[model samples]
Target: MELAKIHRLDISKYNLTFLPRKEEMFAEMLEKVDADDAVLEALKSVFPLPERNTDVLLHGDYWPGNILWSDGKIVSIIDWEDAWIGDPLADLANGRLEILFQLGKDAMIYFTEQYKSVMTKVDYSNLPYWDLWAALRLSKFTEWELDENILKTMKERINWFISQAID
Candidate 1:
């Protein structure tokens, strides 16, 4: 999203923040995480609540692999398919899951803390919604992967997605 508009340009009216009020987005994540039902249910109720962050620049797809490094130093971030104008926390939440799985949990925590230090206006509570949303997308990918394979592998991935919630 346009973090600049929210912070630098001071344009909040055109922003669109979507944190849905349901577990459907998050179900795949809860399946993989085995997140407690009580917690997910509570989040289902709270996920739709709004937290505006006008100035935070979001990388659109802030996942770990997207954040490029060269010779042990940071270079550039890639992938802008989902980039838009909205809450930066959504990107943070979406990026966190990819970081945790692709970069390891410790690094994810470190990056989160580092990002937290730079955040000024927005609360990061809406992260779960974003996390769930990404998980659902992953589940769809899993479905597509299943379809591309033969009977056995297809069955396996399908079962995995079902166990994860998008089958």
Candidate 2:
């Protein structure tokens, strides 16, 4: 619930804000991925995410890379440029995808379950939708810098998550 603690903060004085919906951004990102008809159809109805009761400060670009280590302990977190005030799920979704890609599906599942346990105060209906959002966030990766096998596995994982989301 570390993230939720930040969300629970009163950052109203900062005047931080984010789009009420990500439809425009996702629409443009569509061309980056080879999504099928079912996925495309699902996108149409997933807009304006099932917003939770309140918005909070988000480390929008949270992931492994942003975390700094010092003697095996987390010392700091960088990359605050993408910070925004929005649904807590947005950052959770980003971290989930990062774990899925950087670690693996099992790790991702463990991480998600742990997050859910910590975040029991909020409704979870937005989770599946956030999962889809996380999957699509990777869709915009065009560099393909990973090894062939790794890339293939990531694609399979992404597809699996997408199928789960669309269902």
Candidate 3:
């Protein structure tokens, strides 16, 4: 839904390195994934996003948990702590990854398709960039430790996004 239009804030403030601790955590994960300096540098290149006029009110954390369902239908969405005015792709990317991690790859595809049907202006080309950013943001979680399977999935997802960005 269209929300109040706000002034554009410097996107660098939302990058993985915005916080020292998050940057450290992301760097550690990159090492575990055997990511080279090039990959690290590429991830840092998400700033100065391609000029666009697609800003919207983003849920910011649009994972399944925040979506309330009634009788198998979404009735409402909760959680607004991360809500902000930013590229809509960020929310799409975050939701896609969450669906893939919580549901499955097939579910993610279906969810994406369903989303595309309603939101016609989605810029597919930049999605991978946002996906990589979302993965890096997820890597900052420390209080809630992820299991080996989840961690592996996250790494694979990150790699896939990186590959998409490269190509």
Candidate 4:
């Protein structure tokens, strides 16, 4: 429904004036994102320490549509795009938002708890960063469109993300 909502909004007229230049963003990430140090430490502080036997699973585009449901339960998953070895919890953030969209915010807590019971791979506390990152990425993908409403919301969301990072 997020895509549907985006499609309904006129995305052809909007302009995100404060978006960082693509090269600048990439350069900053390259300089600051130390996968072995920064990300690992962040993950450790935010999630349960990985068990010795834990295995990394590639979850490409792990979200709701890829999650199949049967009789009100998720019975399967789909989609293989962008699937690679890393953190599956990264996808949980997106899944959380999707659940909130489909089942409402009130259901999110319970849904999240259930996910934790099953995945048991990461904590939910720091997932917001990943979720916001995904949302910002999505917004950037459509940032050049002409939709005023879409652009405004995208700008607001992206700016909000920048503020969070800065603070």
Candidate 5:
């Protein structure tokens, strides 16, 4: 479905900063991923981001778990607590990372292609940055879960996104 209308609420109301601000949490995540200073420095450079026009409502936590399907169709999107008006790519990036983690890179590619087919106004150049943002956002939670495999996968995904952002 296309987002044909914009929301009246602005992003600032959500207290949504693009990147994580908790130094301790970020440091812990970096240690878990074995991310070096260079990586952290690179991420820092992208912050204080230039203002972009908010064109649609973003499901701030868009992931497979939040989506319900029936008869091979999306029946409902259940979560709205984190919803806000912001860059639509943020939603795409969150969904993309979760799909990549659950499925694979190819599935993410397919999803991206399908999304782009309908969302013509998408600025692809900003996706990698958003992807990195999503990864970092997820890292906070993934580290706490006791599953070793999931933790490893999350680290790999975060590093991969970081590499993409740096490139």
Candidate 6:
């Protein structure tokens, strides 16, 4: 709700500017992944999206840890450094992926529903593109910081999550 509200704010009056859209960054990162040929192709197809209105303010890093709570209700949503002025789907996709990994697919679906319930007019055409973008962005989970068992589970989940986007 808070994120949707943020997106709804009339920030058009401010002269804020964001860097080039993230597709270029996604392209650069994709080259290093050694992903399956089909997966790579699917990702490539969505890039250089046709120019359109990018009015919403994205909470570029919308995930669990950034949401703060006191008692029970959320008191704050910290971490604004990654915020950007772009497609609202970026935040929704990233939030969905985080929920899938931290909680489960059911929770991710519920969260998506809650978000959409507020953002009634959102066009979800690029949701798959952004989901794959998020999955790639968060591929750092494949790192060595976690124990082997946890890593194994997360890797499998990541692959499944990727399949969800591609299929």
**Best candidate, lDDT-wise?**
6
1-167 per-residue lDDT for model 4 (tens digits): 22112213332354433333323432344355434343334433534433322223334355566768779876666775544333444455555555544455556567667666665535444455555444433433343664777556545544454344324
How would you encode candidate 2's per-residue C-alpha lDDT over 1-167 as one tens digit per residue?
45565667887676554433344445555556665666665665766555564766778777788888889877788988767666777788888888787898888788778777877776777767777766666675546687888888778877787777667
- Top candidate by TM-score: 6
Query: Rank by lDDT, descending?
Result: 6, 2, 5, 3, 1, 4
Where model 3 places Cα greater than 4 Å from the true spot, the runs are 1-40, 141-143
- Mind giving the per-residue lDDT tens digits that candidate 3 earns over 1-167? 21111113344455433222323433455556533455556666655567454555566788888877789777777887776655767777788778777887787788878776667655667777677767666655433678877777766765665576567
Worst 10 residues of 2 by lDDT: 17-26
In candidate 1, which residue pairs clash? 1-84, 3-56, 6-54, 6-55, 7-54, 7-55
Whole-model lDDT values for every prediction: 0.51, 0.71, 0.63, 0.46, 0.64, 0.78
N/CA/C clash count, model 5: 0
Ranking by TM-score: 6, 2, 5, 3, 1, 4
Better by lDDT, candidate 3 or 2? 2
lDDT for residue 13 in candidate 5, whole number 0-100:
56
TM-score of 5: 0.71
Per residue, candidate 5 scores C-alpha lDDT tens digits across 1-167 of: 42222223454556555533333433454446633555556556765344453545677777678878899987787777766555677678778888787777788778878787777756677676667766766766554865898778767866775676668
- For candidate 5, what is the lDDT? 0.64
Clashing residue pairs for model 2: none
Which pairs of residues clash in candidate 3, taking residues 3 or more apart in a chain or in different chains?
none
TM-score of each candidate?
0.55, 0.80, 0.68, 0.46, 0.71, 0.86
On lDDT, the stronger of 1 and 2 is: 2
Candidate 5: Cα lDDT at 20: 39
Candidate 1 is scored at a TM of: 0.55
Which pairs clash in model 6? Answer: none
Candidate 4 regions off by >4 Å? 1-55, 70-75, 121-125, 140-167
